[model samples]
Target: MATRATARPRSIDFNAAELMVKTIKGLTMDAVQKANSGHPGMPMGCADLATVLWTEFLVHDPSDPQWFDRDRFVLSAGHGSMLLYSLLHLTGYDLPMSELQNFRQWGSKTAGHPEYGHTPGVDVTTGPLGSGFAAGVGMALAERFLAARYNKPKHRIIDHMTFGVVSDGDLMEGIAAEAASLAGHLGLGKLIYLYDDNHISIDGATDISFGEDVAKRFEAYGWHVQRIDGHDHPSIREAIASARDDERRPSLICCRTTIAKGSPNKANTSASHGAPLGADEVAATKEAMGWPADPFHVPEDLRYALGEQMPEHAQNREDWDARLIAYREAHPELAAELALLIAGELPSQTFAGFDALLEGFEVGGAIASRKASHKILSKLAANHPTLLGGSADLAGSNGVLLPDTPGQSAAHPEGRNLHFGVREHGMAGVCNGMALHGGVRPFDATFLVFSDFMRGAVRLAALMNLPVVHVLTHDSFWLGEDGPTHQPIEHAMSLRLIPNLYVIRPGDAHETLGAWRLAMERKHGPTALLLTRQNLPTLAESRAEDVARGAYVLLDPAGEGDLDGIFIATGSELALAREAALRLAEQGERIRVVSMPCWEAFAEQDAAYRESVLPPSVGRERHLAVEAGSTLGWERYADHVHGIDHFGASAPAEVLAEKFGFTVEGVIERWAQIR
Candidate 1:
């Protein structure tokens, strides 16, 4: 929340609003009918609210979906995706009628859920119950942060609003509660959510499971609350207008809408919530609403009216472009920085000077990998304006603080360090928002074990191919004193299972920095950096460049003879693997110690490179995978795996290591007889 500045009220003509609503409903009904599988109730119910927001309130240029200053509208109740698709089509986005006809079909952009990059106007991929609700908070925070950093007395280049239509299910989710609390605490005035208070869910009436007073709940979270008749255009406009006046809190307008606003039979029932309306019901509903019988048909006059609205939104973008040009002439350096940030580029020096930095970063030291990542962040934040993130209230423990910046809060909104409280699930969603917002590179940190709480958001990030970094520390049984409750036994292997998600368990300080570098550079998807809680000795042969290859030979067999076995490991276990290999060498066994830091990254390597690391001749039973985690996924890489498949005990690091058979001697003994 920055200073309160009342946004001028803008209204769509009543006739146009009514037509738009009718068109939206018609499209939603027909799309669901055509798809034979999708939700239509929400789209029909919230049509009026969405119509007002899009035509009157949302500051977007459909032609230029990536306009930096455009307002974002997220459908948090994403099962009602037809609502978004209909709106996108009506608003002149690249979504054509043909795509609408092929709704939910394979190879079509109009998927069951609104996917971020797949759809032209979708701000973020949001299908899970409260994901969009939480992510909207992140988008608002990003806007406030950029506005504070870039906006001057008269040039408000970064000012924008984040709007979302949340469903009953979204409000019921704990993630939304956590995010809403944070948004209110941070005073995110630009964040406004219109809660579609239609009292039906998959089961039945929400009263069956959800009976809490949602307006009061939001008010308790420090939000500006308003309740309105959802179908009443005047109330919808008035509530949104009132919401814009309050800049000290996020706003939630609870609109009491019917499940299917004007349906003849299924209007207020659960029947219309998910399944498509039959042809007879659709026709009857259309006749009742005074809509045409033809599927996907919108009135010509309504289409023309909607077309006219696009120029108003496009003009704002054109004006912003002109102002950007003038601002560049007046302040060249700031303009260039802004351009680089929006393009997701770092400063020229940081981008090109990484080789030199890595060479210096290869200094050997016995330090926790978390501290090494902290060191990398310190250097990156010093030069990269786009670097921004925070831990889940674990800055001291997880080491995610930027040394020079103040914490982001209600008062100091310009600070780069975000304080995400203790909400790991909420933090992941917010990080996704910051990444989706473009210009800010956001990372979230928490202990590796708590990643289970945040996995839903992490999976969505991977699905959308967002470049969010998750700094997970206290990686394994090495986390010790916190005991079994805090240790991560299967986090590395489990996280590696996520498609397109890069899971890197770096060996030491240098490899830790390499993981950070990889996370920063990989823009196509999210990255999880698994670091150590205990201090790890730096290897003499640790090469920063070798990390990019995912797994590299840390120590080769002493003799030129055939390799007897390969000891593959990651994180703290790599050190033990090396020691075990050395001990085996004394007994005439030639074992190769390979540091496999990132399984996902290594899998992407060419067959030649992969074969070189794990040669086929000395394969299968000869390969021993050593790590203090579940042995579930190691079968892909090793024949015999030495890993903890049971819960750990409460003890010191050394005791836990020996108890779990993770020590060098333990590994050597196990390797000697395993085959």
Candidate 2:
């Protein structure tokens, strides 16, 4: 398709930026008019600034769309989707006008909002007000992590910016405020946002709900702010340039413009906010802009002129490819590794190295699931250059980020890890964006108790089937002294309710490693690793590979397995189940102890596997379970469960375990009652 747009402007001065913007506005309007549907107000309003960025500043190759170093552009106010769609089509991205014709229709490439993995050149999904803004933060954060880790003096391998075109609605969302504050605090120098201040929202002017000093608020959050008249192409270009030149702080460029610039009666009117301008309004707008081409049509001369420029973009990509090829000569291994990583493929050595490391931990140690998770995560991070993660203000406590890979402090385009500020919800949402961005495996960490704050994004992760692992620690009330607020009495059971999620609460070190292995292998859904805060002895019989089986018979009566009693347990209480089995053995009660670590994984197994573990028709009259959290999900395993159904209180670890009934004695006592 021709990259050119519109016939000659036939104006006194031929400004490329103005012409580009006007061309996009004209095209978007025509598409809407043709389709009889779409949101066109922002496209008409902010086209100038958007064009200035794309033509002058944006580093992208339409010919090679997946270029790693390409600048990311997000349409945060997805209601103005025609702005992005028309740009993608006119700027020579893979999207064609036919896709625009199919806009908002089922099975069409162009959805109401840009969906990740569905559209080419669309970086992240954006629709729910602040979600796109938060995703922009993630894109900028991803760029930072990659830049910090891989960029060298000679090779600027990861020095790209994340830019977003946002509207008043995006600013109104609380999540946007949360993300903006965090982004500023981290000094994300390369995040340049262009705010389209048309002053119009769906409910009319933004004065009704949004009246905060955004400039002052962002400045307080530690960002560089610049304000420009949105219609002044030169001024907009200058602000974009300044933001690009900045190296110490992130930037926000506020561009002031009219809502609908040329619809005559509808210009700056609330009527233009959603619906397309009427036939008379469209003709009137076209006449005022001096556009003579028929609706849904462009002159061949302009098409040819723009077609010549396609080579300019193609050459940029071709040159980058040539540089990469030359770089491969001197650095074959690095080049090959990067090639695989960019393609979302793991290095062959990753699986091999992981297995070698697994051998050492097979025997396992008496370590808490949390501590064991760290050991395994640290080892994996050591070998996998692509592994990156951080906690939601809980790094030291959660053991998610190891010491070697420093926490991502600056928003460098290539940093390996990110330190998400106290916004747990924003952190989870951003990690979702990173994983969906296609070039990274992003992870987030937080205390298991704070998981309530992140449940929305966690559900989104499961819904989208993104492999964003949540490293959840302090999994139960065994996290003594912190009391009820810090304890996760119901979180584990709560997460189990997610359909495709894998909720793994490993018993010991070996099992922790096993959980990570399964998590990586099950790439279709989110995985929550519920690691314990307190240490528990890595039991003698428990193994990592066995834990990967979801649930297994750890200890059972040697003969006549038609059990009189059976004990089920997870985490530290596995030993209690063993103890209960031993006590039952003395009474000549045939007993089986089942270690159920991952409910989601066990549920995925066939009926035979689940039946073998839980026994479809349990003949045992005595059945009991020992765990340190709410007895919500475990009730199916046994009618009588010895667990903390209520909140915990401040106390010593041993004292709390005894008080909460998470003990061998408790399981034995509960077992006797079941009998």
Counting only residues 3 or more apart in sequence or on different chains, how many pairs clash (N, Cα, C under 3 Å) in candidate 1? Answer: 1
Per-residue lDDT of model 2, residues 613-659, tens digit only: 76756743456777777877666667777887788888878898777
The C-alpha local distance difference test score for the whole of candidate 1 amounts to: 0.88
Estimated TM-score per prediction?
0.97, 0.85
Off by over 4 Å in 1: 1-11, 351-364
Worst 10 residues of 2 by lDDT: 1-10
* Candidate 2 residue 546 C-alpha distance from true site, Å: 3.8
**RMSD (Å) of each candidate, 1 decimal:** 1.9, 5.1
lDDT of 1 by residue, 1-675 (tens): 233235554555678778888888889899898889999999999999998888878888999999998998899999999999999998899999999999999999999999999999999888899999999999999998888887776666787789999999998888898899999889999899999999999889999999999889889989999999999988998899888888879999999999888899999999999998888999999999888898898778878888878778778799889878877887788889989889887677554555655565544558888987887878888878768899889998999889878988879988889888989999999888988898888999999999999999999999999899999999998888888899999888899889999999998887887887788888789999999888988888776777888999999976589988999988899888988898889989999999999888888899999999889998778999988899998999888898998887789999887777787889988897875
Highest TM-score against the true fold, candidate:
1
Clash totals, every prediction: 1, 15
Q: After best superposition, candidate 2 residue 249: deviation in angstroms?
A: 2.6
Task: Judging by lDDT against the true structure, name the best candidate.
Answer: 1
